[model samples]
Target: MKPLLFMILLILFLPWTLRAGDATLVSGTVKSITGHPFPKADVHICDSEDGRPDVSAQVDGKGNFTISTAFRGRAYIVITAPHHRPVGHAIFLYGQPTLAVDAVLETYLSGTHVDSIQIIGDFNRFEFDNGILMTPDQNGLYSASIPSPKKRTRYQIVIYESKGAGPRSDEVRSINGIQYDELEYDSAGDYRSVINTTAPTTTVSFDVSKLPIAQGTGYLKLMDARERDLVATMMSIEKTIYNFQNAFIAAGTGYEEHAKLHDSLNTLLDADVEAYAKQTDDFQRELMTLRMLSYVELSGSLDQQQVGKAIGFATSIPPSSIAWSAYPTALGTLLKASGGNADTRAYLERVATQNMAVDVRPAALYFLVGHAADHHDTLRQVTFFRQLVENHPYNHFTTSARLSYVPRTEIVVGKSLPAFTFPDFEQPKQSITGSSLKGKFVLIDLWATWCGPCVEERDSLLKLYRQFEGPQFQIVSISLDSDPQAVRNFRKNGPEMPWQHVHLPGVWKSPPAELFEVATLPKIIVVNPEGKIIGVTNGLKGAGVDRIVARAMGQ
Candidate 1:
């Protein structure tokens, strides 16, 4: 009964299926050039690159094939036959019902067929030798195609000369200050070949003869005074980076050349950022900022004054703009530039706690608490930690915050060392507690691998270990890393913290972080044999570390 109803429905809608807006059906003919022997071609079809379903078929004796699949929207069709070049076509099947793609397989070559020809770009990870091979079929356009899930992608072409010829010894040529060298065909300053998949066109072309190759400086000169415009400056920067990348290929990728190019790129980036500031069109400014602001602001060369200007621009972002639609990473940049200080704290409090237009407080406060301990401001650290935990506990920023606040509020120099027990790093079952070493002068060091200050203080820790690692003087380094394996991994290659190493996961929210009232990492609590807290990280970091340890030992 179901089959009979389906047959009736097909009879009723057969005309519509053959016409427009029906299920996607691709029919094609794979014709081999006359007199060129080739096996039956394999027809490969896929909807998208990201693990989407794919369908395959084979060409019949007459070189005719049809593919019926559930794929809609963008579809990639590839045809490959033995001893012949492969061909791929990109098509949009959203509004179309049935499509016709004819592929002609050719075992022939055109113009001086070099050692190899390949397409390299974001699609192929830009690996020259391993790029997608382009084969000309019956002297058709030399091209390769991949279904782009992205709206568009940029690519360059590479051609290798025969091995006997070796590499070119001299610069091929220079046009408008752009040099295209490295003998083997390098698409250096070529107008970037971008395939915008937004169009429903089936085949994307890369005809080198028609490309505007090596015309960057020439394009800028034509722009003339308009080069000062933000978009124009960004274009200029893009061309400059492209030229630099080609130079890397020409010069053999070296760190020295990379550093020099980075300096040059940074200059152009500064200009682009300056242009962003002066952009008069609000929408264009937002667009430009969205594109290049993150690059410029995080370049680490932006002066405090420049950061001030950027902060103002970020604040001015209209709520409706897509730039403001997502969490403002621009705010995070400003907060990092300011670092943890009175001004940064005030900003977070006003912006987030006060419910200002752009709420940066929740994120900013978490970072402040982490950095506050670096400067040895326990008061400021605790104050903001409490505020973040109490106020924005469920905000995405605070969700990973400390699980619970430490009960012991203050960690003074004269107070009794806070009691605690943690498993040894290597022997997890063996407990290392405050009571384990009753007669020795102990140093309870709280730290994690992710802490920059703790990493810097490693040499100091090693020096103290060497100078006074004895029975009378003991140091137990406790880690607050969330991953126990991370501590083991760090110790594997990093400076070995061999003396009584202990692991206590959850750096910011652990019992150890709370017991010592850790403001920041590399926090060392010095205690006498009597278990009285003698000193903190303050005297145990610089030149004072050895002095305090020797004093603790009473030597």
Candidate 2:
């Protein structure tokens, strides 16, 4: 099962999903790209990304599935079928019950006999089309064109071969930021073989002379020897980069430990891994570039002059001057106004032009584009977006990047919200719709009774509501709680503030959750009198929310 990554996104953006609304009904259908009816698929309705399903239903023999749900603010629907990857979309159901969404399901493969395998990471998520099979060349060498993402992303690849067995055992070997466990087969039964790479907390320069290659291995061992040390160093560097990134985003204690690990990795750049650096694979060169980038970031936590010294050291080594896939973006963010822009651009462009994989090019462009956009170069931004669309129109992320530059008014925002009608908990006779607030400043708050932060923010929300509760403003609270009883009890016992409240029988896929990208709870959206969004507050303090409400009300 995929890690509950959605849960994390929900927590991060909760302030936008929890909102209360009037009674309304929302209905939708599911279909394929080819207009074929989809059946027996599970449908979900939730308030935010973390919204739980209030109502779940399946299509009949025909491809149509419609269920009633409330539209407090924004909602989303996720659909899944056996042997098919789940797909979801966002919809705004202010109160219109007749909303329709036709979804397409992507096919997923199962079972063994797997051919070429591809991976997705910081560069991109893995897709079926991206995989390539390993083929043995005439020279008795197995080779495959495994591309890496343009971003300084890390990934690991594992190869499983079934041979001589009651079942196919794995001959797992990890590479390119990928990880795997070695599978050994003998009469005794399947067991792990050697632990080839030790987990290093910090990226360390491997001393090639100290490494030993045993004399009694097979042909695979011989080929591995040609690249093993370099591969090991690259993997270690990649791990270090991940550690730094995690530390950068993680909250609370042990931060110093992470910082020390970052510094320790930088120390390896000067330790002389020249033997691996001279290898034919691009692995070592890439590792050096990554090390230099990390060194640059590490310098910032120290003295300011230390950064200059680190850059001077980076400039001394030709390969170290470049940025690895994801490093350019990090470095750009870190060194924006510093004079490192020129060097960073040069390094990024060089990587774009290298024998690097197909996905690697766009990341360089994105970093450069980000820098240019930061400087308000609309032409450059347009050009980059256009390039992305033209070159990678079919790529999943291309459209998202294209949409980023577009003002909300021009695309999915400003338009009248969708209509929704669902039953109230008491009588099952509640209906909600966006049209009810045709000319009011609708304060949409997406929350769940279970979310501690959300519960804490409710008081401030109530205060804000009371302050703005005249003809010009209204508050809509949409609960993402999966249980209906919880929503009713919480509203009754938690806070005495008077406001519109609606609970979608569906949990996370509620029509409102999808509309607003309510990945997090406790989200607050300020809708103008024209039903257009004025601003969105992800985690604003109650005081901050009050200020926004006052400004919206012209107080």
- Please provide, for model 2 over 194-280, each residue's C-alpha lDDT reduced to its tens digit, 9 standing for 90 to 100: 223433221211111221112121111112232334334434555665554444333223346545755564455444344334646
Query: CA lDDT of each candidate?
Result: 0.52, 0.48
The predictions' CA RMSDs to the true structure, in order, are 19.4, 23.6
Model 1 alpha-carbon miss at residue 31, Å: 34
Residue 259, candidate 2: how far off, in angstroms? 9.7
Scored against the true structure, residue 17 in model 1 reaches a CA lDDT of 12
Best by TM-score: 1
Model 1, span 212-232: residue lDDT tens: 222111000111122124334
The estimated TM-scores of all candidates read 0.38, 0.35
Clashing pairs in 1: 189-214
- Residues forming the 10-long window of minimal summed lDDT in candidate 1: 215-224
Clashes of each: 1, 89
